[model samples]
Target: MISGNRSKAWRIISWVIASVLILPIFIMLGSGLSATTELFSHLWDTVLPTYVLNTLSLALIVAILSSLFGVTCAALITQTNIKAKNTLRWLLMLPLAMPAYLVAYLYTDLFDYAGPVQRFLRTTFNWNSPNDYWFFDIRTLFGAGVVISLVLFPYIYMLTRTAFEQQDQNLHRASRLLGLTTFQSFYKVGLPLARPAIVIAISLVLMETLADFATVQYFAVNTLTTAVYDTWLGYGDLSTANALASLLMLMVFLVVLFEQKARMNQRHQSNRPITSSHEIILTLPQQILASVFCWSLVILGFLLPLGLLVLMAIEYASLEQIDELVSTGFNSIELAVYTATIATIIALVLVLYKRLHKDKLKALPINVSGFGYAIPGTVLAMAMLATFGPLDNYINDLAANVGIEEPGLILSGTIFAIVFAFVVRFSAIANGTISGGVEQISASIDLAPPSLGVGRLKGILTVHIPLLKSSIFIAWLLVFVEAMKELPAVLLLRPFNFDTLSTQIYQLISDERLEQGAIGAILIVAFGLIPIIWLNRNEDKA
Candidate 1:
């Protein structure tokens, strides 16, 4: 009877936690869906159509470009005998650690007409003005897509490469035996098998493209994310902003559905373990082309931007900048610590409930909690404000009635909002990591704990906690790193006079003076690298 009551209590608590996490989103969506027709018409007549077009166009372009880059790179690394395959494989993933907006700012500074590259061209060609030669502008929509794809293609590359690596070697051998060339075998067998992974990857890229704000904003490309930002802060139109956010949220939900479907189909694909490695040997000329392509991606995507930041830091390092970095870095770290702790704890509770409880809807809480990962930061920020803003007002009113000093916007106007947003945005990471860890424990151990007269909570505390220590630490670290690098949500929800490394660097980029914030940018990139390096090391070990 005690165990039944405890299970019931846990089930209720898990559902409550899930509901609370998702409550803001539902509230925001409700406000938008029920918004006045006048506001909807106003948006539609003015900039809404343009924002929608730009958002879709950017998503489409980035999807295509990322697919091309990722698929080609994965194919070369997995299907062909690419020189330095091991080195190139990990290096390709490093670009993901470099944020798209930072790359955009750095590359623009390099290739703009007044920058060194153009100046060098003019000096060498003896050209004076615009009539000398046409130059490609890095600030255009297409350029934004390319910049985003540079960092995001790694998602595709990693997943597709794994799919290719795990494909049944027998299929490839049969294709080759049927008089097919290496390329034909790859196209006929390998590509089709990896299609589900490619689709899932592209869906992820599309969701990310839709979520991007700083890159599009810096490039003066008005997408839904920027539109939502401008509507909320720039124009103070909360209702309209909520409406726009809801629209963007709807789009993301579609992509999530598509990705889920692809993931389901993915299970039908061949997962036959590799018995032997069969690599297509490249001709000398082919080797040269492949090497150049892979190396160029690495150089352009990660090495160049990182090198520029390093040079900027060396040239512009100062005590004043360091002081500011330390201050903002503390803010970022504090926020990340809070978010990581809360998210990990919540993930632990929900995942454990799902695992140990006998409830019919055991998985519902975990599933609901993870929905926030699909949400863009901008939308999540809007959701936070929409839900917490009114709640804060009520709290203040109650405090005043009780003759207490009214806490001014404690929830909505303080770090609480930012931390909540981060937790909501990143709980999925913790859930996934913890769930993976939980899955590794033996089922017999679950019975053993109960058979040994250990209560559920005590058993988990003593046994499962020790076993999952590494996963818990990793989950905390991943959330911490993501919170540090997150810009859009923090930018929207941060209290006045508060800043993080990402926000500080964004400010400098906006002012066209990122040199002053190069250290902060470097710090953000370094934090972003923690998970990538950890993942790569684990994969290598595996």
Candidate 2:
């Protein structure tokens, strides 16, 4: 009876936690239903169709490009003797430090008509104006797709590289002995074996592509995310925006379901490491081609835009503005730290509970909590507003019923709401990182403490927590970088005067203050690059 009571108590606690996490979703659905049809009609006529088409095109382009770059680089570095394989591996993966939108901003700032590249071309060729040369339009769907691919490809690259690196060396040797060429070995053995990782990475890249707003908006390439913003704010149509968001959500849901089915259907046919021995020396022509490809990708993805940002920052530097930049930099670091701290704590608790209990009830909260990543920042912001709006009203009403004066303590328009939104949106990064760590641990280790008569909680702390130190650190860094770059959620949910680096950049860009925005955008990218470099270091050591 006492044991039954304890289990029931835990069940109730799980329910409460689950409800808190899922409350925003429920509120959004409820509020969306009540919004009028007039809003829907307005959106149907303007921006909706273009948004869907452009979004689909952008997503498709990014997926194809990211897959090509990721899979090719993985094969080159892992299966063959690519020159400077270690250097190429890190260079390929480092683009993860650059966000798609920031890339779009930086590229446009450098290559657009008034930017340096075009100006230099005009002066060199003695061309009179914009029409003289067929310079690429950096504000089109093509431009946005290219920029998105530059940063997003790293997702596929990192995953596929890991998959390739972990493959058995024996398989390659046997394939070669059987008279198979290196290319055939890769396709027949290496590629098939790494399919699962490639698919998962592609799905992630697709999800992020769908969720992106910054790149699409800046380039004026209308996508569903930008449409959600346009429908809600531009047309004053909440219902239509919600309906559109629901559609976007459904698309992600279908993709996720497909991924789950694919995972179940997958079979492990190989269990050996592909590159257990050192890489074989490539022929001179092959080596040259490999070097060229690696350098070109690295230059395009990392060096070029970063160099431009540095130049611009130097051009604008003055003793007075240095103090302002320093202050904003501190604020950015502080925001990133707090958001990472909160996200890691929540993710750690959820992971621990799920691992210890391994029950459907406990798993539900964490799973749904991670779904915040799939939802766009605009949709999440609306969900937050819908949740807090009524809660505040209810609190005030209750206070009135009790004849109390104030009830504004509810977190409606405060920094707490912004932080809460950040936690909800970013929990996926932390959860995935922690969960990946936990999965590496052997099952026998989990059973150790329980068999020895230690309670589940103590076992988790003493056994699981100790085993997951590296994962916890990675989770913190991932969440910190993501939070630092977060824009739309911060934009809508921030307090009356709050300004994080992301929000500050957005404000400057919106106001056509490109130089100032460039500075903030650069800082955001630099902070993001730190973790990517660390990850690369770890990969090299492995």
TM-score of each: 0.98, 0.90
Question: Against the true structure, candidate 2 has what lDDT?
Answer: 0.77
Off by over 4 Å in 1: 1-6, 268-272
Question: Model 1, residue 298: what's the lDDT?
Answer: 91
Per-residue lDDT over 1-542 for candidate 1, one digit per residue giving the tens place of the 0 to 100 score:
11442467798899999999999999998877776788679879988999899999999999998998899999999888889999999999999999999999999999999999999999999999978799999999999999999999999999999888888788878888999987898898889999999999999898888989999999999999998998888778777789999999999999999998988886543455553667889999999999999898899889999999999999999999999999999999999999999999999999988888888888999999999999999999999988999899999999999999998998999999999888889999999999999999987777767777888788889988999999999999999999999999989888999999999999999999999999999999999899999989999899
* Candidate 2 per-residue C-alpha lDDT over 413-435 given as tens digits, one digit per residue, 9 for 90 to 100: 77667777777788888999999
Q: Pick out the ten consecutive residues of candidate 1 with the lowest summed lDDT.
A: 1-10
Cα displacement (angstroms), candidate 1, residue 340, comes to 0.9
TM-score of 1: 0.98
What's the CA RMSD for each of the models? 1.6, 3.2
